[model samples]
Target: MRKIVYLLFLGIWAVIGPLHAQTVKSDSVFLKLQQAFMAKSVGLLEPVLSNDFSVGVYNSPIAKYMLQNIVSHFAVDSMKLKAVERVSGKNSVLFIVYPHGEPAITTRAWLNDSHKLLYVDLFDQLCGLNRYKVSTLQATIPIEVKDGSIYLIATINDSQKPLRFLFDTGADGMAMRKSLADSLGLRVAREQNTSVVGGNMQIQVSTGNTIHFDKFAVNNQSVAIFEHVREGTAGIIGINLAYQYIVKVDFDKMIMQLYSMGNYNEEDKGGTTLSIKNGKGILELPLNLKVGQKEVTGNFIFDTGAGYYVIGFGDFVKRNELLSSGFKPYFSSTTVSMGVSSPTFTGNFEKMTVGAIDLRNVPGTLKKYREGDERATIEDGSFGVKTISRFNFTINLAEKTIHLTPNQRFNTPIDFMLGDKMFSFNERGQLAVLVDITAEQLFKQGDVVLSINDIESETLKKDPARILKLQAMPSGSKLSFKVLRDGQVVTISA
Candidate 1:
């Protein structure tokens, strides 16, 4: 699908189309901007996007000096515009750029009615829009699924220690947990605090002169290190890896394949292709979901980093009357997200359907969009790994399709249980129990849970990621936990 609004992470420039030429030379502006990007020269880029500029999702504007300092470290090449169309008004133009083998990028430029250059919205690609060079022939790497998230186990920097990263499309480049970064004593390049649409958080961006993934034996990769991640996962490996290789994620056999660019073929694909559009880094898919008897179709963000199966928007669900009248609510601890922290909670979906595939009593979580936050309104919902892992799904960003085939795991039931009440993290960094637990309690409101099923509480304090692993067990599965109540260790079985 075509879009005009853009993200700041990707590069951007404005060249007015013939749609409106009341003021300036359109061709000259485009040629200059295009030449500047190919040369990787900030001096040329500065004058084009000079004066006031802002990041895509947030309103925070940075001066040209700061933007110049940031782009000075980039290595860019093979840049060319693929498509452009005037939108919003004659002044706003949306263009698609094809950077050699990299994912196709969408950018937007706003101009004055007279067609004078205003500014462009660019997404943050640290390498400054370079295509990753394909190196290997064909390699199929084994993948593991835990708590509904796919993990790619790899050895970094030739170290014998294995690194686990959540296979994520929601991230720009890649991220390393600060704990691992400090433990490995990685050299830091730069750190910056960023303001996103939802809330404010700190992003510690790091660069490596040469870091090797001994398995793939890759080097000179740029990685970002964040302050926090879900427990049991070190960090995230963003979808940018697709730029260098043809990535195949098989949910059927629980494996992932990375084939060298020239080694991949069209015969390897089958089933219905899921259409996706990337205005920024997030891949949005067309989801025609059936909630109870009502069917609603909307575009859902493809978030492999998230664990839920299908998170419906509260307004959408309520309008469709998905839940039975006054269905009892069960609170679930799921998000570590800077956004959607205050989402209104509701009950689960008894059944759902994706294409011809029917899912029974599927486990899910619904998010009530936060007020005044544009990020929450970006999409109608999010389809996470939990729902996707049951199908053999292959994502081809180059072709812009997510292929899906129902696997043997498709009909398998999802066994999920949260106690009568629930626990989640509030803004104060304290646990919020949604229901009254003191009356008929297994655990109290303020009790710090030491562990769930022997997993430590260190990471659970940030999000309930570690505790969610046990949700896939059979209905008869037993749940055991250890908690700290009033400075004493207490064991309980549920």
Candidate 2:
């Protein structure tokens, strides 16, 4: 009996020792992940971040730009990891984070056998939805529409022959390119006059119906088509389809899910709830401010499409007496393009306060306009992605709630011009790269630039056989240019 008891004790001790060691290792792994996230180490984070995450907040420029700003400015003031829940029989863990200066955010981290995080999902607590399962209409590749209310994208056409569309939720209705519509043999019924607020833009809407997608077919019942849209997009699915379902955009797996009415799950809601008012969506946040030593009430828009921070000139001027009292521009090297519809200013503020929070040396752009009127349309200075990206935020349309959570994982501000460049093609199929840099010695916008060493876009397109001969040029590579600036022909070297 004593020998049996001894054997049992030995067996229990052996199991418990290994279990305790595993627990320690798991804790260590979690800590390492937290450290990497806080450091904003992209290389170290690459091993842990899930590439298969999607954020389809009705494709509003606000949500897109806000999240983009967060990733770009990858730094946070404070991050508190409050708790972690590990599910049985799964390699995933749920984390609840509290940000000091911002709102709270919930995220999921999945580990591989090597104990490295293979996936991470940033959740919008208001919607309780992830990238993959935000909707019920499931397809590997889907299309999208950008109405102001919903960021709607869908998998159109047959499953065997699939077509994907991305709709801008900021837009009014479904739209597509003329060339694409012609290729599809779509017939236009009538043209209606339509106008957009920003940039003094206007378009002619054409209503038509055809077989949109094979699986998610849109005859006359499912869609209304418009042509010659804004924002240089191909086409849209629009509010017709979006209003009927809860939409989700899964960027990770490159898929879209649409949930029918009364079919949403209660797992984890994301985004802030919103309300539609007088043909516009209103997301009002309470704020306290002083106007001439008198407290005044003010409301701002949650505009994601506007990329930077903008403030009302009238309000600012009245409070600080800036217009009549001239001040020097903060930065000496500031320039702007002709068609970009941002405000103009010659002064900068050392600090600006939002509620009780004070932002130092906040780079604010001032615009000339009334409180809420732009080109005869209702206009309000919006809180753009620049300020919103400092924390994780969501708007719940269902609950009519707005939630703001500070994100601690980000602690680094990204240099935009140093990271990536934009590219497009002219009408002649010649690729035009809108180099996102202002190297006065090298290149400038509207320069009708010729070539960068051997990287002549026109030459490359004409000669397909010489594809392999092309290579990436160094950052500061020397190049010759034939520029057409202000109708004069000049030659320069850099």
Candidate 3:
């Protein structure tokens, strides 16, 4: 069986392209606005946007509310428009935003017949368009989740801190790590069989006193604490404590905004929201999904922590015949580091279609272990950067909706995707390769990348141009690298 894998990433642009008459010329208009914002030109945006224009940053009425709530006093280091494209016959312009230390982004704006801005919407790489507001506040909160009812994770304090907890929307109460529980002198929530939509699991839970989130503090909060939680995960602030207000996740600015839920009165909101149905839940998107000839539907966890797409092995074996098709398919297998126990087997699958977009050769892994007669079932899974990089996603938790837009910069370089290749940072901050290898080469994982042809690693870091020429190298051909293994530098020809 032939194996196929669909991979994607954020893309970047070098220069603005020339525009035809009715279309706005892409020169520095976007960049100038970015710089103005960075320079705190709060008074200027009003004129540029004009009174006749209404900018909706997240495709909802709340977009304005978000910005107004935060921007009353906010500061930004920088905001750069990497690329711009005209949509809907020049009436709307889609802007892709790239900010330092933030995830990839794309946003949409609509202009009235008079060329005045009508509305704007923002999209994060993982979650789709969310109600967002640009604020002068220099602080930002970033969140991520591996698995759960809610796809997002929250960080209240400093993001770089060694001790931190993720916010879970599905958990009935709060949870905490054993280490933090020990330090806080709090007892673990009593262990019980808690039933979640995904499945039933055992966890410790307890109530807490006060929960602090930056300047926004909740006093005498009924917070649940879980002990013996996974390592590196200090605890969780779940939905039982969440829904207090209108929440905004601004990926472009790398900020998470929390509003008093009372402020959200307008019914119109972002993306489709999820609701309980027959003891399960459903998050409906506007698009349809199909696999092979069958239409696939179910509740799926929008997990960002899963580096790769995963599915239950039993379903894979039952539904897919790739293994017996006579082709040797290569699968990415790694240790399951989430909880405890031994390593398990995981296989990859091919071909997954979401509406008209067909992801060819997309890889999947078996998520559960198998014993004779004992079968395991997995909750549905959704694509992440492993495949979602092809498009921009906007997740509106308030509305429980997700929006997908074609990502212009869908294929760009990021550190996470650089695999098995030895690299050093060049002066331009780009990862520069110090060695070259081909399909036929035996490039072991730990093989020290010494030098490229004659250029040494040190020299390559100083000059990235050395490896750029290797792009012309043919597959299956020998590429030489001087490597130091054991000790001495030796030529390890690939």
Assess candidate 1 and give its TM-score to the true structure: 0.54
- Taking all chains together, each candidate's TM-score versus the true structure is 0.54, 0.40, 0.45
Q: What tens-digit string does per-residue lDDT give for candidate 3 at 339-392?
A: 322222323234555545555444444333334202223334434334443333
- Candidate 1's C-alpha runs over 4 A off are 1-137, 193-198, 209-213, 266-270, 290-296, 312-328, 332-334, 338-346, 350-361, 375-377, 416-494
2 or 3: which has the higher TM-score? 3
What does the lDDT read for residue 302 in candidate 1?
78
Residues 1-494 of candidate 1: C-alpha lDDT, one tens digit per residue: 13444533233433333333432444445555566656656567545452223322111133344345444533344344533445555454455555555676676555554444455544323323211333344667778776557788776664677888788866656777887978876777877664332345666776753333444554566677766665677777876666455577876576777755432344444566665665445677767665545566776777787656777655555555655534445664435553325454545566565555566555566654444444335556677777776667766554456677766655443433455544543223333343443355666666765666776644555444555665556666666668677888888777
Tell me how many clashing residue pairs each candidate has.
7, 63, 31
Locate the minimum summed-lDDT window of 10 residues in model 1.
51-60
Considering every candidate listed, which one attains the maximal lDDT? 1
- Look at candidate 1 and tell me the lDDT of residue 324: 53
Cα-based lDDT for every prediction = 0.57, 0.42, 0.41
